[model samples]
Target chain A: MDELIINSELHQYKIMIGNRIRYDINTLLPKTYSTILVITDDKVAEKYLSEVMSNLQAENIFTSIIPAGEQSKSFALFEKLHTEALTYGLDRESLIIALGGGVVGDLAGFVAATYMRGIDYIQMPTTILAHDSSVGGKVAINHQLGKNLIGSFYPPKAVLYDIDTLSTLPRSQVRSGYAELIKEGLIADEELFQSILSSDLMSLSQDQLHNHIRSGIKIKAAIVEADEKEKGMRKYLNLGHTLGHALETTLGYGVLTHGEAIGIGLLFSMYVSESVYTIKLPYEPLYRWLLNNNYPLFLEQLHVNDLITLMKTDKKTLNHHIQMVLLKNVGEPVIKEISDEDMSSYLKQFLRKLVIA
Target chain B: MDELIINSELHQYKIMIGNRIRYDINTLLPKTYSTILVITDDKVAEKYLSEVMSNLQAENIFTSIIPAGEQSKSFALFEKLHTEALTYGLDRESLIIALGGGVVGDLAGFVAATYMRGIDYIQMPTTILAHDSSVGGKVAINHQLGKNLIGSFYPPKAVLYDIDTLSTLPRSQVRSGYAELIKEGLIADEELFQSILSSDLMSLSQDQLHNHIRSGIKIKAAIVEADEKEKGMRKYLNLGHTLGHALETTLGYGVLTHGEAIGIGLLFSMYVSESVYTIKLPYEPLYRWLLNNNYPLFLEQLHVNDLITLMKTDKKTLNHHIQMVLLKNVGEPVIKEISDEDMSSYLKQFLRKLVIA
Candidate 1:
């Protein structure tokens, strides 16, 4: 597989996709860095660390394994990683590699972001969900109040994705990861949406997976290039993330994977868009597909007030109002500040309607 | 009092050099920011925080006070500030004002730098030593292993230097702060050097104090403007800090004020410069002036090997060798990589020579 390149303001890097990429990660690293620290989770470390180290045989590499899951995205872990980096004698010339899913990527990337102010880092994602986080520079850890509440917009030097690792992921994980791919299609490409819609997405061929991820990355790369610091166009990437993050924060992180929450958020966004903006979207089809795929739409568990409260604290919120990205149709997204009455009314309507499908 | 401007790459901010800036800080901030969080030490908060908040009567402002001294510059404090910021309902539009000496400026500025990734911050430095740290936007918290081991290159939105606060400083502090003023002269301007050498530095007129600070800041601003991220010319500004930081880290922080450590480092640098680069400097006069001003030369307690070990871990040590800033003459600085043997030999000779002086 060829590399997909992202040209950001302060950094320019490539996303190299292939099967068993762990063996080639060493070659992708910058020549100046003699010291490499690979930060992964216990699960991923057991499965893939040695594979990555096999290629890094000639390098002075150090590996630190964090506990698996969202709980590891913490201040304590961030501090611990820095201590480990210091203990391993990692210097400014050294590099830190994130070698797991988004949780590991977010934790290790943030550690790299704050360690010695900032240091060079690479992302070698071993999960399907990491495709989105590994591309963008938005590295962060979860605060008690919210997910990604404390973080920096730090871009990675490279993103090495090994598709073979996806085989090890549960079916739910694979389906959840596909939500962002759907978002990229809905927000930017109508043809990509229609193409995926016509297919049996559950059993995607290697070529299908490649095209989906490449297109998703291309959409992400273009948006980030225009607004690397998330000033304007980059807000579109948070299409399903506002309510998605709110759910993640309120419901507890590990209860639902990122893509599952985002899956529900995406459906609700379409409903709200139709209600508020009179934007005609494929809300019925998308909602059906979401439920059929085992993504639990936990609308009954959440309240409008709690979601609204969480939405207010969002980094995207300006002047205490939620700036949501609503689509008129596939490939046509617009940002709007919704009133409280409209948000509350829409949530009531959506929850009332959810009894059937 | 007029605002002296610092033009950086992404941000250009003012250094409001005056006698009483605490009262008028609200007027200096951007009107768009509705939320303000002031990060200060207990000592400074007692003396200055109320006055600052009095002016910010219309804005929803918050204040957090930490214990005084270098210990406050820790990862624990950094994490606590973020938790406090989140608890205080501070959003992305919020501004954090650092109202203390270099400790507050570095610690609080780092909080703002990493909070929600990056946020706006103002530096209200309440000490003479803070003038140097406040200007460059090189904010950081100290690691247990080293001072400023964990930090970033995030610049503050403004530097509010209130010279009246220097009146609260002890004479030792005042003299210690003067070392950086001398360094600004040595690295960039000989005229500033000559002016300082011929004067009663302990009891300067207010106008003399203003001129010295302004000249020092001008020297700093120019260097930072040329190299905001410390890639090239900015290395010169660290004329004495390579050894200076090592001493502060190994000997324990706050044991010697930053200026006191830098003063001794400056003396040793000149000696090494003379030996290696044949740089003609007034080493005798500088040494006498240092001792005359109560700057302790702690030569007997420190060993050459320990200092060399600390220097090896310095951020400036490129490719496992010390990249020190040496001067050919006043205002002529160059970066050099000194060998371990060369470093040990120079330290032994420098320590031996200190016995006579």
Candidate 2:
């Protein structure tokens, strides 16, 4: 097992990445809680809930299984989970275990964040997409207005990333989840990026997948430690997220999985970066790589004007100026404020190329 | 104007208390924001919205007004505010000014807390009850099952407490607000407690009210600074809140103002203290004081068992044990976990006395 510690101004927690790390949960807990509530999605619960529950060492244990997918990250579900926690008599000393992918982790992590003005929770991520979401402690529920519009930077007590669970994920989900790993490489680690680009992401050996996931988490952990609130350097972590979020919002959440939207976003960001910086980037190769992986890269149904407007509403956008993370080099990400005229122009060129291809 | 600095692990904020401090808002802002959204209740907006709007120094200013009272702290309103914020193009660099009493402060503060994963907000408390709520960073919205069940401990950038706003409050509201000031005294400052006890709380002069409010904020600031998350010393600030919250939840919120419920809780905590610790408390004199001030001191509409059941669901309760803040003496407070049997007996005795009186 590989272990890493995430340091935020508010908390310092560990991330354990290995095969079947779920069983090590007892050893990872900071202390014994009064009661433990495991929050997962229905799909994840059907697969691993019983196994995880049997391994948890707590006197009183309860489970709240939400419907699987991005729709689960809604205010209605957020409220329902809190009601369930209260019904189960979960208190200050209680623990909430968020078990599943990004949707479950984000929703359940947020429930723990605001439940009684915050309590301890562990992220037991069961999908590859969760490799990024579970580590950074950026928990939130989507607002009707935008994705992650209502959220908090509340860190979890610990994260147990059991690779064994990833075996159940479908091929499309794996491709979607791998986009974040690619994002991690593009932002900070060129070697990791090159390795992922060279390898067939769909059929990586268990050991190879473990190394890439560990690298992605370490890069994220380092950035979060320096800027937990995203006042400065942390904004770089939103590499493709500005447009990715806009796409997710424009498409209506769950129309495209978060990672799939991000896969398209990564290509658009690279195109914008090359245009804005007048620098050469592996834009074509990366685009071809995404297509090869079966990522839904075409946004023919949407207009550049709509996506631009939605991008302005992004959390990263400031003063209604679309601030996008663009790469000057493979490992160098810069946040540039793109005016509507410039953003619309770049977005048009990028979308036009997608249509041609 | 009197200034007190509240120190928390996450952030440090200032509390400016005086007559008409609302006009001094621009001076108190830590920095200029991109946009400013003022969130207040309809009642407060009628009196001060235009004046506040005229005084605020921002290029873009927007106001979101909700219905007055505790009902405003619902999930519906919470979601509405976030939607309004997004509609107005408020972003990470924008600020939210909570421009009413506790309801507005809590709802707006929670919006600011989770808006774009937290942003800068200032608390412009418009009532005496806010003297306590405004100082602490405990921001939240109410759940259907309980009060403040959904929330975060995100502190404001600053607090502008204008004593001038108190003149608009009704006599009942004054009595309701004064109970918290009295709680501040009972838990900490004996001299402040004695001064308040001797005075006619209903009719204090401007200078006297300013001094008492400042002192209350100082006591609270000290406690919050020592323990921001209510992990230890901060729980002392909940001296009257355990039963106080139970009463508010039982009474269906807004039926009894928060401070009024707290006034009754103060009396109950004293009663429990006397029973469990075998110590003398000024229960009778305090009871008479509450009656003299026209605080609703009777619970004939409710049963002790129902309140007890509700109390068990309190955020402070641990492992199904009712942990309450009890005064050992006038100036000292301690948290004691009372058995269900002891709690039921003490609650019945306290109610019986209230009935006879």
Candidate 3:
């Protein structure tokens, strides 16, 4: 299959999506690096690293695998990666390949970024959920206090998406990954959302899955290209992320996959959007679709006040004011500067209420 | 004294050195940033931070201070700076000002470079020793096994050197700072070496100190401008650093300041240079001068084999081959590819004699 391209205009890089492209990593690696360090998690490495390694038969490749988990993206992990990289004799002329999902990407990108001021890195995302997280070059790791509290805007040399790897993804991850696709559509492509909602998502053929991932990536690409540093238009990409990140942080990460929290947060935004905007959304149908896909819309088990407190601590908050991305409808998002008073009522009374079919 | 101007061609930044320029920080701050975060150490905060804060009087100026030590410049510290920058409401529109010596500069520069990919930073170096450390924009921190194991080559927007702060420097620090001046003269400027050797460095007139600092900075700036990422010419700057950093790592930091370690390392290099090159050097005179100045050169009590083992792990080593910058003679340096055979004997026999001197 031909690689689908997501061009980020600001940074001037392309995200290429295809199947089995991990076999051709050198085509993307910059020739300047004398050595290559492949950073991966234990799970991903055990499953697929040898395939990635096979491509660089002539090159010097070093692999450092950490235990697979969000917890691995810690100071201790960063220190280990630094020591191992040095022990393997990696230098400024080395290329660090992040060969797993978001945790690996964030930690590895950070390691590469700060390794010698910075070095080159190629994103070889393995998880189905990494489809959305892998693009836009926002590499970060969770802190003790919050998720993605530490990171950099270090763009990858190129991103290689191998669809073949997604075949190993568990069904739960497939559902989780769909939330970001839903997000991409909600932010800019209403037609894409309709197509996804109307389709038999679980039974998608390889070609169908590739197209869906590409479309979602393209939507994200356009936004990032317009505003690479989240100065303006890129903020729109946080459609469900502001509330979603708060929910993830409050609930504690690793408990819920990122997309799952955003799935719940996406429904909450629908309530805010319906009340505050002119666009009329199919709220009941959308909620039903989320339920059908196994998303928890009413997070009653989570303390409402705690979520509010977590939202206040969000990186998106300015002067303690919650800045929410409220959708005009299914396809359009408008950033609403919601007052704390109105946000609490919106979350407690309306967001908690569910339309059970 | 007039401010010195050194244009770094590699990174393309103009370094401004003067006395009390912290009073004029607003002029140096790039207009691109809407806000600024000042990254400092606790010790520096107690010493010169008030002046730095007062100069950046804008309401958007925020300050975050970490513990004052080399220990604080870890992966954990890097994460804290990243988080605090976010917590202080920093965005892409923000700038980070490093208001201390090498530690603050390295950590803050790494933070700015990695926070959201990269941001702008200004170096307000307060120490007299920072005359050499501040320029070239090589920001880094220590790892467990070594110093500056994790870092980036992210240049600051500008460096404003205020000489007035040097008045507060301890006497030991002033002597330590002059080692770089001697280093500059040894490698590139014969006249600079003679001038330092002839003069009483213990009591320098303000103008004299400024002239020496400016000359050293100009040399660093010229080299950095040519090889910003240390591809070739910048390796010369690591003359003492290879063995020096090893010494510091082996003996443990805090036991010896960076310049003190380098001072002894420089003497060691001189011995190596004498063996490999025909260049004439007054090594005995220089050693006497350093001893008179109360410089601590680790000798009899320290293990020679341990230091050599540490040197093997130095970043300057490639494929187990130690690359060293040896003085061809006064004012000329030749980067030699040293063998392990020569390295072992040079430390045991020659270094033992020098230490007894």
Candidate 4:
């Protein structure tokens, strides 16, 4: 088993990664909670809830099963979970366990963040995408207008990443999850990025997948430790998310998985970086890699103006200026405010390139 | 203007107290926000919205006015404010000004705490009751089941308490606001408590009120600074809130203003303290003062079992044990876990005492 410690201003917690690490959950807990509330989605519950519950030894145990998907991260469900916690008599000494992917982690983490003005929670990420969401204390529910529009930076007590859970993820989910690992590489780790470019992401050995996930989390942990609140260097983590979130909002959530949308966004960011900096980049090689890996690289003929409007509304946008994280080079990311005219022109150019590629 | 600095783990901000300090809002701002969203209730908007808006210098400014009172601190208004923020193109660099009493401060502060994973917000308290809420950073929206069940401990960039705004407050509002001042005294300052006991709470001169409010804030500021997250000494501030919140929830929120309910909770804590510690207290004097000041001193025909149930569900309750903040002596508070059996009998005795008094 491998463990990485994440240090934030409010907390310091461990991210334990290994096969069947879920069973060792008892060891990772900061203390024995009087009651334990495990929040998972219906899909994950069907597969792992019983096993996790049996392993979790607490005097009082309760489980809230939300419907499986991005839609679960809504205000209604967030309230429902708090209602459940209250109904079950959970208190300051109680603990919450988020036992699913990014959706559960974000929703449950958010519930823990605000429930009784904060409580202790642990992240048991069942999917690869959660590797990114789980480490940082950024837990939130989506508003009708945008994704993660309501949330806070509250860290978890611990994160137990059981690799055994990943064996059940669909290929699309794996593809979606890998996009974040690719983001970690593009922003800060050239060797990791180069390794991913050279390998078949779908057919990675258990050891290879484990190593990459660890690398991604380590990179994320360092950035978060330095800037827990996203005041400065943390913007690098949003390298592809500026356009990535717009695509998710425009395409309608769930049409493209978070990572799938980010895959296309990663390509767009590189294309814009190359143009804005007038520097040579390995754009064609990366494009071919995404296409070869079956990442949906097309924008579905969406209007550039609509995409620009969505980008302008992103949380990262400052003063209505769309701040896109572009690569000064691989292993280096810089935030640049793209003017509407420049952004419009860049979108047109990128769309043209996408069609030709 | 009197300025008090609040230092927390994540932030350090000033609480400016004086008459008509709202007009100097520009000088208190940390920086020029690209846009500003002023969140106030309909009632407050009618009285002070235009004036606050005129004083607020920003390129773009927007206002969201919910219906007045505690009902505004609901999930619906919280969501509505986020929608307004997104629609107004408010961003990370934007500022949210909470321009009302505790209701607006809590709802708006919560919105700021979560919008785009938190933006900057300042408290412009227009009511005396807000002297407590505005400084603490305990921002939240109430759930259907409990008060402040869903919230976070997010401090504001600045708190501008304009004593001038209190001129138009109703007698009920004034009485309600003073309960918190009484609580600060009961927990930390005997002089403040004795002074309050002697004064006609309904008819304090401006200077007396100012001194009392300043003293209450300084007491609160000291506790919050020592324990920002309420892991220790901060719970002392909840000397009355355990039962106080139960009263509000039991009677239904608008029936008795928060401070009025807390006033009763304060008496109950004293009675419980006198019994549990086998000590004499100034219960008679405090009780007489509350009665003379027209603060509602009775619980109407509510069952002890129901109130006990409510108290058990309080956020302070640990492992299903009812934790009440009781006075060891004047200005010294201690948390005690009251047995359900003892709690029920105490409630009966307290009810009987109220009837006789």
- By DockQ, who's the top model here? 2
Q: What are the lDDT scores of the predictions, listed in order?
A: 0.83, 0.88, 0.76, 0.90
Which rank order by DockQ, best down to worst? 2, 4, 1, 3
Candidate no. 4 TM-score: 0.98
lDDT of 4 by residue, B27-137 (tens): 778888869999888888999999989988989999888899888889888888889889998888889999999999999999999998888999999888999999878
Model 2 C-alpha lDDT per residue in residues A20-85, reported as the tens digit of each score:
877767877878875999999999999999998888889899999999989889989988999999
Question: A127-175, model 4: which lDDT tens digit per residue?
Answer: 9999999998999999877789889999999999999899999988988
Stretches of candidate 4 exceeding 4 Å from the true structure: none
Off by over 4 Å in 1: A19-21, A30-32, A57-59, A298-300, A340-342
What is the Å distance of residue B255 in model 2 from its true position? 2.5
Q: Global CA lDDT of candidate 1, please?
A: 0.83
Report per-candidate DockQ: 0.61, 0.88, 0.43, 0.85
Predicted candidate 3 versus true structure: per-residue lDDT over A118-218, tens digit per residue: 67787888876787667777877666656666666677877888898898887667877888888888888888788778766568788777878888888
TM-score of 3: 0.89
The candidate maximizing lDDT is 4
Backbone collision tally, model 1: 1
Badly placed stretches (over 4 Å) of model 2 are none
Specify the poorest-scoring 10-residue window by lDDT in model 1 chain A.
A23-32
| TM-score for the A chain of candidate 4 | 0.98
Q: Give the worst 10-residue stretch by lDDT in candidate 1 chain B.
A: B23-32
- Per-residue CA lDDT of candidate 1, range B1-357, in tens? 757787876678888888886677767775557788989999888887788888874457889999998889987899899989988878788889898999999999988988888899988887777878998889888877677877888888888888887777777677777889989999998988878776676777888888888889889888888898787988888888878888888778778888988998899889988988766798888887888777888555677888898887776766577899999888999999999999999988887887766
Which ranges of candidate 3 are over 4 A from the true structure?
A1-16, A23-35, A58-61, A282-285, A327-336, A355-357, B1-14, B24-39, B54-56, B60-67, B79-96, B115-120, B281-285, B301-304, B329-334
Per-residue alpha-carbon lDDT of candidate 2 for residues B1-357, written as tens digits (9 for 90 to 100): 887887778777888877887787787788988699999999999999998888888889999999998988888898899999999999998999999999999999999999988989999998888888888898998876678888999999999888998988888778877888899999888778877777786678888788888888889999888888888988898898888998899888877888989998999999889987899999988888888878888775577788888888888889899999999999899999988888888888888888788
